[model samples]
Target: MTEHPDHGFLTEPEVTPEVRASYDSDVADHGYVMNLSRVWAHSPAAHDRLFELLADLARLGGLTFRQRGILVSAMASTAGDSYCALAWGGRLATEAGDAVAGSVLHHDDAGLEPADAALAAWARAVTRDANATTAEDLEPLRAAGFDDRQIFAITAFVALRRAFSLVNDALGVRPDRQLRDDASPTVREAVSFGRAPADRPS
Candidate 1:
């Protein structure tokens, strides 16, 4: 783990001219630039190049933005990565109009249609143990209507995000202050909204 730098752009980042234009649009759309954006930009050229690659890959995944975000969140939480879980998870919850369970913790097939459940379960299984994933796993997702290409793309995204989580944790990077702060008022109220059901039907 590299030592955390004292510079804001090093420990964090502010907008760079080349990246700012794109970041501005994203912030406008989402109401805030994600903290990852800031952190990545600390190495402007490298980060921008990598982000461009990631953007291309994420687009190839063919899931809706919400779907992609949810898969990432589930994997992060399952892997015990709180920073990734809270960061993207909170954004997902806000986007879903229900910050209560952010995509990280919410997993009920009842809420998803058959196809979505299959996709989500595939994500869970991969996160739990990639070596354990088999053709049988893809079978359910394929039967539920996901194409092979989409499944492969999802697999890629999961792998990429997991790599990202490893970096943040090894660096001992604290959760972004913005996320910690934005996690207030309405966001907090919604995050703590619901309680889990106590009984599990056997």
Candidate 2:
């Protein structure tokens, strides 16, 4: 993986066998080692933990790929997490149609299904200011047909995303060139807030 000098990592951490394996898997799965993979290389166990949590969440959440992208984009954007915003925004654009994804990213829920719009708003409230959310905030979701168990799963997903965002943002980890390049223009435009893209290695 190419290293960006200004990411504020004081020492280059050793790549353990497990880390190398994970990098190999990343390249195979996504065609490149993600920037987050590089940052988490400092602690392979942490890297493993993150993905493990995501895996478990995926099984329990039961949200479609499109729904997950929408939720992740909204939550990440609300929290000013540029990395996840761009990544998931791109996925949303690809999976749910550009117009719908663009609207969500732009913070305009026009034309979105009631369920999607409600989920988007809920994600924002959960990420930016959970205390501001009241029972009223949940009424929309319940009206949109989500049950208590589903609601709990959705909140868990949001919490996990916040955890992911905190790890990357606090450490100055930047978006990878491959990731940025692969995103659609609409997705790229929507994620202009928060951290700047990572500088490439000289």
Best model per lDDT: 2
lDDT of 1 by residue, 42-149 (tens): 565766676576677777767776777677667766666656665666676666544433323555455655665665677778888999987887887778766878
Compute each candidate's TM-score over C-alphas: 0.68, 0.91
Against the unseen true structure, what C-alpha lDDT does each candidate score? Answer: 0.60, 0.82
lDDT of 2 by residue, 19-42 (tens): 798789888988877777777778
**How far does residue 61 in candidate 1 sit from its true spot (Å)?**
2.5
Off by over 4 Å in 2: 1-10
For residue 29, what is the lDDT in candidate 2? 88
Model 2, residue pairs in steric clash: none
Off by over 4 Å in 1: 1-42, 99-106, 184-202
